[model samples]
Target: MSLLDLSWRNMKRNIRLYTIYFISMLVGVIIYFTFAGLMFNEDVVTAIQNKENYKTIIFVASMIVFLFIVFFILYANSFFMKQRKKEFGMYILYGMKERQVASMVFYETLFLSAISVTSGIFIGGLLSKFFGKILMNLMHYKDDISFAFPLEAVVSTILLFALLIGIITFQSYWNVRRMQIVELFHAKEKMDKPLQFSMPLAILSVLLIASSYYTITMGGTSNLWKDYFKESLLATTVALIVGTYLFFRQFSGWILQRMSRSKNYLLGNKMLWISSLRFSIRGNTVNFTFNSLISAVIIFGVGFIAVDYAVKADVVRKEYPNDMIFSSQDNRTQQQIEQILNDSHPILAHETITGIQTEKIANRKPFLDHPDYYTEEFTIFPEAQLNAIVDLRGVGEKVDVKGDEAIVLTRGIDQPKTYLSTLPTMTVFGDHTFQVVERIRFPLLSIPTDASGGSEHQPSVLVISDEAFEQLKGTRPITSYEVYKIEDPKTSNNVSRQIYDIVKRTEGSYYSAFIDMYSIDIESSSLILFSVAFFAAIALFALASVIYFKQLREATEEREHYAILRKMGVHDNVMKQIIWKQLLFVFLPPLLLGLLHSWFLLYYTVILIIKDLPALTTIIFSVMGLYVLTYMIFYVSSTSIYFKIINEKNTR
Candidate 1:
């Protein structure tokens, strides 16, 4: 057959295998683009928006996804090469030039890349709308940004994979180039010699394990440890990864080599264990390597999201205990609020607070930027309305006033404009009556009920007294409600809902605190689930599928070689042992190393991620167990197919 004909035939014959590759690529696109959409969604973006040098997080995350795609696709290409090695080797023996064969392989890769990319992009377009909906739900997106084709993001994604395919094509060519005709034809005859452990390797492994433990545990979180030990911690992680590989290489082989020595203990499936372990290491060199890589990724990935969820989950409930939060323009509902709270729940901690928004003046006179802090916005606010809204957090607490004059608290700056890095400037207008009081800080978290142009993002108001607020706000009404922490927030919500029913039937503009809390919870949960599902799918599918596919090809190749030994008088049991044995050794080192690598990764991720330590551990362990179970099942299924193929070829 002509070279073009050979390439075309291979594509058709290997269509099933290529389908795996194509599907994986397409799935990866869906996953990554979904992640991008989530990050850029308006609700989630509010958290990330222009927050002090935070644009880099999106860029870094995107780059990681792009690089991962490139590497993963190329890794999958190894299967195409493995399946075709015999063909390439035989063609060379039959007088087909190496260059000609290389050209053919390159053409096949190019054709495959083009086809896969086209299919992926087409599928991506269809998935985007559904994907967008999922993202909106996750972010609890109250606001929306219009979605278009996103030519820039999509085009960049395409070019990235194209470059990756180009690299894969060249790598395939390189493999073909390095092979001699004899080795190609006799490729199945190549054997992996048993490995022996060196003292240096064993010592290094011990040292690496020790260092990794110390670095990861880090004792506790502190600026002192973080500043001085960060680099060292990173270095130790690298060491642990390297050490895991080394340990696996020697330890796995050493165990198998010593297996036959313990005949008494070697009874039962000891043979299977030994055999499988060896074969795993040998035939699955790359598989083992990648499994380790994935193990590490999951350790960090799941740990981060789970921990963040647990921590934030608690804080949000305490901050907003009710369903609907609203404030009016006046402060006259103190008695009504108490009545409602008593009516809603018997256990109510009723209190009234007053607050005022700060004002500034260019001269002795003052002008208030946002004076609505004295107005009654929410029905649950304090009696005088200026108790806690004015003069809070950064600008207010640090200032001092003498007699009629006041200087607002402000940070000393390297430059005038840059002083407000995380703070706002104290403004003044000409000839405005301004009296600065003693600056003081407000509470950590509170939303502005003062909607008369008062912003929630800026510094807040603090009320010194009820009378002061009443004088400032001019008969504004205060928010009225019962504030109490129940034994169960979940149950508290239900009770509040019941009370809300009562309020709604009897009055206008009546809202339940329970509804507000429930809505926020729903929003947060949706976003968390959205992020976890999309990212986890990408990580799992890419890492697991690649290892599984590679292992399948390797098993097939090993089955061919094992059959030759069977004909040379090795017993059937021995033949099976050998086949399983090779896989065990090949798989052991990489898989074990990968697990260790993941362990350290989980530790570091826990440090950076804000959360409960227990949750992080749980997620890491769960993901690791999952990878192991999936791999085991895949191995069993592939092994059966592997032996079946060999049996058919031998009969032929």
Candidate 2:
């Protein structure tokens, strides 16, 4: 028989073993092709209005997918070769040259790669338009997308897969050269060696993981501990990687031993399951650790993306709660502002807030031990104007300032101690002082000069009685703001963007600053949301591939032990149960640990990125649900494959 005929027969015989690799490659190529089509989609490009952005996303995402596919396919090739080492030894013993054995293996890999890539591209092309619509929906694009051939995408995918197949074939050819006849025959049994661990190493692993969690949570906060920021972050990341590996390496066997100590638990096939888990752990420490970290990375990365998108979208409304605010110097400018406001949309209501500027303003917060804080000049308003604007905007109740008391609009301080402790009194321009009766939160009439853009300042806006305001009046420059509320605030978002564009076109406009809430939300959220969602999908698919490939390898190695159990009167039904239980034991630990890791990640993420954004809670829960569903599919598929492998009647 020809060598090609023999290779074809070998491939047909071992097609079941190649299932994981085949599916992984197919999925990878499908994603690549679908994204390529979307990148070239005319309607999508028009809707996004940025062709380069879509192109860049597709290019970078494709490269990431390609790299993952290369690593996965190469690893799968080596794993299959390792599993068939004994068969290769038989070939050598039958007077076949090593070169002939290597060529046969190469041919099998070439055939499988060709089939996977071809099938994947055909399916991907069919689904490309559907995924394009999904992307358009995510980006809030209104263009009606239609399907196309995406000939360039097809050619590119084929070329990329061809290169990948070539690389895989080369790896197979190189791998068999190093295999000796004796070692090849004993390759499958080599993993049965006993594992050793020390108490000190085990303790060290726990300490490292503990310290990593601490650093990630509390060590990165600023103010006092800002200097060691880089060091703490670096230490935590390293500790997590090394500690996670060591933990799985030593902890696996230890767990199995402890579980076996209960006599009732070790009864029947329970002990066999425990034994199988121990063997999997001790022999595959690196694989277990790798899969665990991959799981953690998927959860952490996807969770963060969801949180960031939600926060960015929410921040726009929080920053600009009112419809529009524009500063004017005098009546002429104020008239222009009113004209533009009326032109933008039907203004339901408007408020004119005048600021009497005062410098060298001293508040109690700065004089306290918090000397690092500095106070800026403030715009003081009288009680009546404050009440008029507050009531017109329907934000807060009108404040009553009594005697020498004033209401301070504080900005930029999250902690109450830093803001409220020094608010007992306020001094304006040299030595004039007034008692502070109340301090309101944010969104005052005039635009805040602070970074937060809210009323979170140290006496930034002081509201006093008209009589007191008249007394402190000086030659200092005055600033004014014209705040307007439109009849339909939601529809006015587009009008707000148009007005902003008009202002940009016309130089020296009346409005010193413009706040368009909807425009800000849409402009920032679209790119961030799309990029994060795309990358998350890529990472998740890659993680699934890695875990799936690893599980298949484990199933292949454990087949013989299961065959023995079948011979010892183990029924097929009982063997199926044991196989699934064992697979679950292997999969669940890493999944649970990954969730625990995400908990620590989200703890800090909520406080920092999604600060005070209540909407993120719902978004986070939804993301978690999606990830769990994906994991469920992976688990079910893994169990099914495992059951099929261990129940086979022939296990030579």
Residue range 1-652, candidate 2, lDDT tens digits: 8789998887678777666557767777887787777767677666553456557866787777678667766766777777788898899899998788878876776777688778877888778778777766655554577777577888888898888877876776677778788998878675655566555677787889898887776634664248877776788889988888888887666667667777677576788787667766766677667767766776677677667665554454444455676554456645664676677566788888777867754444643333224246667888888888777777667777777877766433322232354557677776778877565655463333221123322335678988887777766666666677776564444455445554445353333222333433453455456555666676666566566766776777778877887788888888878877887777677767777777678767563655677766676667667876777688888888777766565744
Best-fitting candidate, scored by TM-score: 2
Question: Residue 237 CA error for candidate 1 (Å)?
Answer: 1.8
Query: Once model 2 is optimally superposed onto the true structure by TM-score, how far is the C-alpha of residue 38 displaced, in angstroms?
Result: 3.9
Highest-scoring model, lDDT: 2
Angstrom error of the Cα, residue 91, model 1: value is: 3.0
lDDT of each: 0.52, 0.67
Worst 10 residues of 1 by lDDT: 409-418
TM-scores for the candidates:
0.62, 0.76
lDDT of 2 at 324: 71
Residue 442, model 2: lDDT of 51
* Over 4 Å off, model 2: 1-13, 49-59, 84-143, 148-156, 181-186, 197-227, 234-243, 261-266, 326-389, 396-482, 486-494, 510-541, 604-621
